[model samples]
Target: MRKNLLANVLDTPSEPRTDYARRGASRSMRMSIDEMAENAKRMIDGEVIVSLDPSLIDASFVSDRLTDDEVEFAQLKAAIEAHGQATPILVRPIENGRYMVVFGHRRLRAARELGRPVKAVVRQLEEIAHILAQGQENTARANLSFIEKALFAQKLLAMGQSKATIKSALTLDDTLLSRMLSVVETIPPPVLEAIGAARTVGRDRWEELKKLLAHPAKAALAAEVIQSDVFLSKEGAERFTHLCAQVKSGRRAARKPAEPERWSGEGIQARFRKSGKTFSLSLSSADAGEFGAYLAAQLGQLYDAFKKEKAR
Candidate 1:
């Protein structure tokens, strides 16, 4: 069944070429010979482009994007209004003559807002094929952020899809698939939704957040921060940054400063303080400067010895 679905997605017909000649009276509306040939090829391949009422189309079963960019959507609506839709969206038929979008969600949305028929290529696809087509199209476009892809993978997993199938759909390797799953699993859903497709936030930043949120207290703090009016007012990237900062600051404020350990031998005294992956050492003696320099110089050798001891 998976093989058949894979083949179906791979062998699906391409979007039909728009008929520029019939678009308008402007010179830009003239179809070049190349475009005409492309349209002829599409016809030969038995591809049909149809206009559907935007009201009849529904979103995909699993959403890939966290939130819509209203500014971008408005721009898309304007473009379609001024120049008409340049390319048709891909959709699969559902019950009662309704359709579910496979890709081209923005185009469908633009058409809907403009109160016009959406140009689309309808294909009959099973669940797996529908997911593959949608994932691959967005992956190719490179518009989805790392977190959005992770959320999509999470949704696919929730649907009982295998990791192999999810990886294939998103063109992700095993390591990346694991990382994506880990991130989604570690972060609270409400926080992720509130962040809303931090378009500028990449994997490293997300991983950092994941580690921070792994602690239940920090995760709870993040949830509270995201609900604040200050956090809500910020945009995508800002929201992510604000959440991270709030969580980190809360963790720091809640932690008590570690007491310093003091050691005295002969005329030398030493103090050491440790706090969450950072440590400080202070020495006071006649040879303190010389001893500190010696220790610094021996760090490499000491680290090697530490590793050897740890292995045992």
Candidate 2:
């Protein structure tokens, strides 16, 4: 049974971490570097497990999850009550003989609620290794949403970690790491905290929100929606959807339509219309094609002149 449980935790195939294990374990363990690293990997891989007082354990310095899922926590507590904890959490010794969790926060929470000692593996990891281990474990689980990962990356950056370290920790490429940072930087922290984890919301939807919030008017609307009773009543992804809808609706309501005007000159007829920031020019007549081609060709110069004027 213990073997089966360990198999469940380590069953997911991951890249061999012999090098990382060696570096992380060399300081504290008395064994040879190679042996210590192997044992460290095995311990994290669930070869050894021990029960620790949940009350004696503290949270990691940085948090990856934005909010608690009460329903899921209840379900997890029930499962542990029935079959016992299948996997052990990872922790490192801190001052006063207390320990700090590296990952499996939900499991620890469940164990605490059940009034039972939590199953955990103790290791001696420096702060960098601790962050990497926590992030990689969650990444392997594939449970965190895009926004959650983005926020996690944001927090790591605020801690002065390098982009490469953040990428390695979260398993992100350069492009993805850039986008995640952009998302968190663009969206206000209060808005993100209010929306919670948004587990169902994905990258594209978040990008859309970022674009909308770029507009000052839409951003204001979002701020209002997040504060309102209706939006506050919603949860998780629903909050994100509600805020998006309110911002869009506010934009539509705020748009002002101008009267269309017609012009006929030099054997060409044209109509000009304006709505909010969008403007349109329609050309008609036999020479319209020639005139339109001319306009398209000069658009770059025209835009440059407009920018100069706006700057003035």
Candidate 3:
């Protein structure tokens, strides 16, 4: 149930409005007195202030993981290196002159990894509010994962926002929001933790997952499928969805008779498991290696048998 502290998007609101409005191309615009004052304070503190004080800020909180898509990552990394930080990271002061990172995580990571000094505007707030604000602000701008967004929405709900309010805050399309909400409803705590741990699961998969919960063991089976790399990648995540449907239809057909796999060496292997109308063929990497050979031999024999029977 523990979260990876290092993967947190913000220890406080990551992209606080001031954090963006005061920096980059927008810096040219006129500002209110508070903005002017903050700017003056920063200049006075020296152009390059070292406030690594992580007191009010949460450095332990991690930025979201970078996507594996190389092109986009390359573009982002290059842009940050060339332009320096176009957006000021949000931070809050801590007790012993420390600061926590709230937003601008991409910039922060780039700076840290590249040995560039990070530019930030240190803001301050209470710890609980800071934590709450952290999720609230970033979820607005970031395309958070289904679980991340839902869990964040739940957090807001705990903070006394109604579902309608949370919906508005998230700005999801109605159909999209409805589907996601159903997922949060069916998934239990342990599964939730798995979901939070970068597991590739969400609304689409949940429609199938929900079915299994009606029969707990099968639900557990579906969960195992989710945790499998082969199924996850090969068939796409919707594999579980289809598998669930198959299980349901198969279970219903159990009361009726069904065709049998003919007895033979490869056919025996193909008849690994059959329940009701649903059946399964067991396979292995080694077996898969020889599958084409096995299929050709077995199917050829069946064809030859049919030809002789017709001739007679």
Candidate 4:
């Protein structure tokens, strides 16, 4: 990768990027580009004209925040100073003359940091609905965090969207939509924020963890289990959930006043299943005395009918 980038740096006529080999790269430094048409320029040198035509752009940034380290920001700024913006950023027009970045936030920030006018390839988005454009943009570029999407869906829902409309707005399937909404609805705010961290936890797995928190005590158990990476790994969280369920079951069993004789024939069969999600119960009773009175009443009625016939 270094050799190929270095070669591109040396071959391009615009300027030798002193920092290209070390600190930063052109947006063409993108590692993959499977979605583009064959003719799209995956790479270019300092000489390529990176222009921003307002007619060809849209507004809105998918990644609204930058990391604390700002390593990408520093590297991007250095690269922009040396090579200029080789690739124009994707953007859409906003309220003022300014445009909102659609995809290249790092590049845009870096350009500003370097005090260079950012170059961006503008695409006209007049016909596309805002939410659809946002969804399409997300779908095309990268995956979203489950929580990020959950929040997005909730925002859309609050904006008067029907369930179907919200699903369409996010371009998510029924199962995913249901799960996302479940997370938003169920997970407590602080715990949800902790799970939203980009490093250790994941949205799908974290959402499952939230379900375990439905019972307050179990929720506290989950909170303790998820406080650190060793405890929050998928395997760890699952085990903790299982343990929580087990303890809960034990507590419930202890709380029960024992089954009545009707269901006690088999004596309360209870066992956990393999998936830890299902259980079974079977009861058989042999008590003729429970029906003794009914049998006697029927016999008495028959005898009375017989006496009436005899009288007749």
lDDT of 1 by residue, 119-158 (tens): 9988888999999989999999848999999999999999
Q: 218-247 in candidate 2: lDDT tens per residue?
A: 877777778777778789999999888888
- Kindly list the per-residue Cα lDDT of model 3 for residues 43-156, writing each as its tens digit: 665333443422234452433322333455567678878875676666766666667776656556667767667777665556444554555666765556666666656665
- Candidate 4 — which residues are off by over 4 angstroms? 1-86, 123-128, 161-170, 199-204, 217-312
- Top of the candidates by TM-score: 1
- Give each model's whole-structure lDDT: 0.88, 0.87, 0.57, 0.56
TM-scores of the candidates are 0.66, 0.66, 0.48, 0.45
**lDDT ranking from best candidate downward:** 1, 2, 3, 4
Candidate 1: regions farther than 4 A off: 1-46, 251-312
Top lDDT: which candidate number?
1
Local lDDT at 39 for model 3: 69
- TM-score for candidate 2, please give it: 0.66
What residue pairs clash in candidate 1, if any at all?
none
Better of 1 and 2 by TM-score: 1
Model 2, stretches more than 4 Å misplaced? 1-47, 251-312
- The clash tally of candidate 3 reads 18
Output the lDDT of residue 113, model 3.
65
